[model samples]
Target chain A: MTIGIVGAGALGLYYGALLQRAGHEVRFLLRRDFDAITRNGLRVTSPNGDFHLARVLGFRETHHMGQVDLVLVGLKTFANHHLPELVAPLLGPETRILTLQNGLGNEELLAANFDAARVLGGIAFLCSNRGEPGVVHHLDQGRIRLGEFTGGLSAYADSLAATFRQAGIPCEAVADLPKARWEKLVWNIPFNGLCALTGLTTDRLLALPATRDQVRAIMEEVITAANAQELSAPITTEFAARMITLTTAMGAYRPSMMIDRAEGRPLELEAIYALPLARAAEHGVAMTRVAMLHALLEAGEA
Target chain B: MTIGIVGAGALGLYYGALLQRAGHEVRFLLRRDFDAITRNGLRVTSPNGDFHLARVLGFRETHHMGQVDLVLVGLKTFANHHLPELVAPLLGPETRILTLQNGLGNEELLAANFDAARVLGGIAFLCSNRGEPGVVHHLDQGRIRLGEFTGGLSAYADSLAATFRQAGIPCEAVADLPKARWEKLVWNIPFNGLCALTGLTTDRLLALPATRDQVRAIMEEVITAANAQELSAPITTEFAARMITLTTAMGAYRPSMMIDRAEGRPLELEAIYALPLARAAEHGVAMTRVAMLHALLEAGEA
Candidate 1:
């Protein structure tokens, strides 16, 4: 199977490397790391195991990448505005586009440009960061929760999940995409927002009782908003507690948005904060805590 | 009239200088500024006029200040934990303790330590900062809205207002202190909290549409929270508009909390953010935006 990886950041490189190692033909659409990866290939250091792709296909422009069986978008949601054009050259009639980007609305953005049926949403439950230009450090939990943007289980999704499973990455195909997105937000809105705003790592945020309570409150608000939207998933009040326990075990992991903020990069505000907020507002769901977090993060960006 | 000034910061020195110039005996309870103020006297550069007290009374220990007819508590709300002991020796039976601090619960904190009748709350509608150890740069609007904490008119309030008016500083004695604090919060919560979190000035905040809307949203939430507590002032929806207009005219003003955060000083989160949030929560008022701001500011402190 031919797979094209867009925005070869940590998430892209990690999964791309894994798939390539599993004997799939994977090409990384690169930006700043183009020359580094092209010269030295991609190197991944993971708790699971260290893997190095000594030589691989890389592209600075999408026009030359051509159409593939699948295209996995790993771009920061802030950069998704360029997606319609960037992903245009990589789509065939049956080529499915899977986005593992954090936040809401990425699949819609993709659906707006490409075929709605071709755009799939997946939430990456992983802690990883780019160690250098061509290097990715995968901390823990490399599972992909896959779903169809418009809902239901599709054979393409099953095949994709199968591919991920074959590559030794856990994958679960979910029925309701919106619900899955909201479920991801139950954790994202608070952890990502607080980590970025406070400049605290996951463990440090959980360690402080004040911040820990705030995190729980934000998560509850997200769940409430999700229910208000009638987007049902496995999310519950217990999800907050579960997140704390999971993140505590994840150690001092810096979430993607936090890393983006620290490195003076554009944040995924639209996907992670704004779109969910808009949905919640539309449903008359009161998410005051998340609203404040959204405002602060927005102000920080400004 | 014998006046004792607690917390000898910018607000303290500014008013103390004015009162001293008005032919009143003013003694400043100094801490780190003791040596400089004692050696150089209190120097104030104000838009109204430049004033220099060639020699002034300064005390390192509150015991040396003795009892006075008026005690101006000009400390930051975060520093009010020391109020009970700091203002102890400076109080007489008739001593009126006026706290010209920003935010809620300041008067309550004072009442907890000193006599309830003796505590007054004043909102300093002025822009000033400590230029140096002994120097205060008064930018504009030196008027103070004075009110008795327990409410209603009092002789001490009248005298204090008269003294301020005589000193060329406009002073209005308000009927309701709690209401006035809430009214001040209509302006304080959004401006101070945003400026502190975003590191943006008043003009910069208003310059961007997104942040400007956020500022307005936060102000509305504050007003909602205030009304929830039954502490009503003249803060209508128009109050947010009025504040924007007023702050726009004030040009680029770095609010006190912003300066404190930038200078690595502890933020007045309890007084400005937390207490109001608790009140709003108690009343079942949904102040999501303010709650988020409170969380962000609190986390920033952590």
Candidate 2:
């Protein structure tokens, strides 16, 4: 299968490398890593095993990448302004677009702009970061729970999930997309917002009793909002504890937003915070902690 | 009456200089400005007028200053650990220890150590900072609302208010000290915490729509808790707007906590956040944003 990777940051580069190495023709739309990747090929250093892909297809423009079977978007939502133009030429009539961006509204944006039927949203539970130019570091967790933007499981979605599984990414095709997005937000809203806001990793945040209590409270707020959305399953209060336990096992892991802020980049606050806050307000649920965190993040932005 | 000033940072210095200029014998137990004040006297640069005390009384040790009728405390709450020793030498039979400190619990601590009837707590609305050695820059707002820790406006409290008014400081004697403290907290918890956390001053915080909304929300939460404590009057929601408007007029004013953070010193989180949060919890009110802000402040501690 021929695939076009848009917004080739850490996740794009890492996953694209894996897919390409698994015998799929994966073309990456590169920015900072363009020259390094095109010249030295893609290098992925992972806990699973280190692999170097020498015959890499890296592009600076979507027109150059042409059409492909699938278009995987990994753009920071802050940079979503460039999406419509970037993904325009990399489309065929039956081209499926999978967006693994964090938070809400990514799929809707893609669906509004391109083919709604071809749009699928993914929640990637992957811990990774970009190294020197061409290099990508996969620290841990690369499972994806994705579904159609319009909701439910389709054969095409199943086939896409199978493709990811073949590429060594544990993939699941879910019956509900918004539910999966909100579930992902249960973790993202607290850890990512907090770690970015406070410059503390997951472990350090949880180590301090005050912050640990805060994380739980914020998670419960998220759950309250999520459950109000009337999803297929209510994300139980127990889920907050499970998340805390899972995060404890991840050690002192920095969320991607934290790394982004460290590198002096704008946070993806619109999709991750503002949209979800709006949804909560629509459901007559006031996510006070989340809104406060969102405001602080915005106020701190340079 | 002879006055002994404890914790002579900014407020102590400014008010001490004013009292000394007004023909009162004001002895300041100084730290950073001890030598400069003792040798070169005290300089106060203020909007009301500029003034200098040529024959300023300064002491390095609290014991040297001895006991006086009044012991005005202007210490940062973070430095409250030094209170017992620093204040012990400056107490008389009826010292009337007025703590012009930020947040809650100052009166409690002082009352526990000294005579409970002699303890007074003042909610200072001053915006000022320490300058070069003996100099203090009085920016704006020197009005103080003070009362007895045991509740009600005592004769001592009224005399203290009259003394401050005579010394060119706006002063008011209130009946409910806790309510006054909590009312001050309605402003402090949001502005001080937000400014300290985001490095944004009052004007900048209110200029942004999201943060302005957050400030209102936090103030409302504080008001909810304050009302639950059975105050003489409920703080209306309109008071949040009034506070915001008042702060807006102050123009990019950095709260004391913000300055403390900027100077690489510890914040007065216990007085400003923790104690208030505890009281709110005890009253069965959840100050969610306030708690979250408190946690972020704690998590971001250097």
Candidate 3:
């Protein structure tokens, strides 16, 4: 299937590179690395094995990329304003928009601008970063859980998941999208916010008994809010412990928000914190810690 | 009345200077400002009126400062471990131990070491900072409410208030020390922690809508916790708004915790956050935001 990648940062570059290597035509709407990638092609360094693509389709403008079967969005949520214009030119009527962005509201944003029926949301448990120019570093997990924005399982999402699997990603289609999203938040809400606020990594945050307890408390808060959202299954309090255990192995992992804060970039607070908080409040659960965390993060922004 | 000023930072220096200027014998147990104060006396810069006390009584060791009528403990709560040793030599049998430090557990710490009945906790609303060793900058608000640790008004506490008033400090004696402390915390728990964590001043913190709302929420949480402790009367919710308005007039004021965090000094988390949280929990109320704030502050500490 032909694919177009928008907001091509590390996720777009790495995943796009993988698809291209698997014999699919992949095009990237590039910004920062456009020139270098156009001149030098794309280089990917991965634990799976390092490979360099000598001939790559890298575009400075999305309009130049024309239409494709699928459009993958990897834009930072803070830059969501640019999504409509950037993703517009890459859409074919059959194109399914899949946003693998962190936090909530990505699919809704895409669905509102494009076709609500065609937008799919996916949670990528991927650890990757852009190195220099034209180089993408894939450090760890590359699994994708695809689901329909309107809820429930769909054949197209399943096929897309299979397509991701064919490109060497551990991909699966989830029946309950909100549950998957909230389950992901069971980890993101605590680790991302705390890490960004304190400049501590996952392991170090867990290493200190104080913050470690905070991490646990925040996780509990998130799960309580998540369970209130009427998901297919209640995210048990036990899920928090599982997330903590999973993150313990990611030793000193600096979350993306931490890097954003240190580099003076605006945090993705709106999508990651505010929206989730509002949604949870709709379900009659208030997350005080998350709100305080969001406020602290927002107040510190320039 | 002879008074021994222990932990003579800004609070100690300014109040000690005032008491001495009022013709009370004031001896300061000094550290950072020992040399300058001893060599050139003490300089107080204040909106109330600027004054310089020449030939001030300064001591390098507490032993040199003989027993006095009152022992004013103005040390940072983080430095409370040294209070017993520091105040030991300066104690007279009838000397009232009055601590004007921020946060909870301070009065208890002193009461345990010295005479329990003679221990008093005073909430100083003074805004002062130590400058250039011997200088104390008293910016605004020097009102203090003195109360006994064992609770309720006392004849001795009433007299201390009158003495402080004679020294030109706005002072009052309170019937409920715990209630007064918690009311002070209704402001401190939010402003101090938020300002210190974000490196923003009180005005800057309230300038943002998000943080301002957070300030209100935290104040409510504190008040809720405060009310559960069986205060003489519940702190009305309107108190949070009044505190906000009062803070607004003080434009760009930096709480002491913010300054301490900026200077890489340890925060008074144990007294300000942990102790209040634990105390509140004993009454079956929990403060998630305060705990999270405490954990974030603690984890970031070296």
**Highest lDDT among the candidates is held by which one?**
2
Compared with the real two-chain complex, what DockQ does model 2 have? 0.76
Give the candidate order by descending DockQ. 2, 3, 1
- Model 1 C-alpha lDDT per residue in residues A1-302, reported as the tens digit of each score: 99999988889999999999999999889988888999999999988889899998999899999899999999988888788889999988889999999988899899888889888999999888888788899989988999898789988888789989999999989878888788889889998988898788888878877678788888888888888876554467887788778889998889888988999998888898888888988988867777767767776786
DockQ for the candidates, in order: 0.47, 0.76, 0.74
Across A1-302, the per-residue lDDT of candidate 3 in tens digits comes to 88999878889999999999999999988888988998999999999999999888988888889899999999999999999999998888788899999888999899888889988998988888889999999988888998999888888988888888999989999989888888888888888888998888888899988888988888888889988887898998888888888788767788888888988888989888999999999989988788888888888885
Native-to-model Cα distance after best TM-score fit, residue A43 in candidate 1, in Å: 1.6
Candidate 2 CAPRI level: medium
Better of 1 and 3 by TM-score: 3
Q: Pick by TM-score: which candidate is best? A: 2
Better candidate number, 1 or 3, judged by lDDT: 3
> Relative to the unseen true structure, what is the C-alpha lDDT of residue B15 in candidate 3, on a scale of 0 to 100?
90
Q: Judged by DockQ cut-offs, is candidate 1 incorrect, acceptable, medium or high?
A: acceptable
> What is the CAPRI rating of model 3's predicted complex?
medium
The residue-by-residue lDDT of candidate 1 on B141-253, one tens digit each, is 77898989888988878878998999877998988888778888888988998888888898988987767888888888888877777654446899889889999999999
- Model 2, C-alpha of B14: deviation from truth (Å): 0.5
- Per-residue lDDT for A191-245 in model 2, tens only? 9999998888999999999899988988999999999997999999898899899
Best by DockQ: 2
